[model samples]
Target: MRMGLVYGCAAEDMVTGLTIQCKRWKPVYYNPTKSAFLGVSPTTLDQHLVQYKRWSEGLFQIFLSKYCPKIYGHGKISFGAQIGYCLFLLWAPVALPTLYYVVIPALSLLHGVPLFPKVFGLWFLPYAYAFFAKTAYCLIEDLSSGNTLNGWWNSQRMWVIR
Candidate 1:
């Protein structure tokens, strides 16, 4: 009951929440009929990117530090919780592969090097399906959350930038 947020972390809330969870505390989500909290969001793209960059860096730091869920929460928390933390914490590293995927293909095309199968090849079906499925899922999720189509498009742009 006397617990306070751990200091020296960029994402103190996340670090504190993980610490509380590791201490065997079960968190509850309360969604009232009305909003319980109101917060301001970044009003510009630069602000949004800076905020996300800080978040990603902090999460990555946690992934590399002793506070890493897989390491610190080994026997204290459930495997699902560890996996969830790893998923969020791994975002910064994930950007590496994303960067390669975005850039390598263009460079290969410029060099006339064939990196992938033809558009009509049988092996291309899986890639096509994965891309479209993820896109549709994201669109449905955004729309379900009450975001406009323009907002969804902007989100897609931000995903690549982040």
Candidate 2:
């Protein structure tokens, strides 16, 4: 949970009507997080939050449903694993372009090619650093607090069972 800081997106702060899209994969009954930009309304933020939670729950069910898990897999796979893969795939549009613009050029320059990127990697360094640093910090916190996924681990140390 400590790593949640980096793992989760920013929380809604105000009731600003947000214009959004319908999730491509969601069922009609599970319609969630779809929004439109409207003037400040007290319900806007709450609605958005409700919508996001709904979408998250829907996705959770879609990827983790008992009836559907056989297709998506369950014990061998797990919900988080599936979602992480999907999320990684989703980042491809931006990541691919970024990789092409940055890594490719850097490698080309290193190989003595004239085609060198303008070093946008430096621009993204802060964010990258912050992400890893926060993850590491949260991991340490979790370890110290003994509040890991499987509950308190250190509190149950393995003893030599005669």
Q: Candidate 2 lDDT, tens digit per residue, 1-162?
A: 111111122221110101011112222223246645546632454575565555444444443333233343344455774445445323324345666776887887789886623447666777677878976776677677646844333323311110
Candidate 2: Cα lDDT at 81 = 47
Error of 2 at 117 (Å): 23
Poorest lDDT segment (10 consecutive residues) of candidate 1: 28-37
Q: How close to the true structure is residue 10 of candidate 1, measured as C-alpha lDDT?
A: 84
RMSD of every prediction: 2.8, 20.3
Off by over 4 Å in 2: 1-43, 66-162
- Using TM-score as the measure, the top candidate is 1
TM for candidate 2 is: 0.22
Clashing pairs in 1: none
Worst 10 residues of 2 by lDDT: 14-23
Q: 126, model 1: CA deviation in Å?
A: 0.6
Candidate 2 displacement at residue 127 in angstroms: 3.7
Of the candidates shown, which would achieve the greatest lDDT relative to the real structure?
Answer: 1
Cα lDDT tens digits, model 1, 11-101, are 7787888899998776776656677667987878889989999998999998899989999999988999999989989988888889898
In model 1, the Cα lDDT at residue 51 comes to 95
Q: Give the Cα RMSD of candidate 1.
A: 2.8
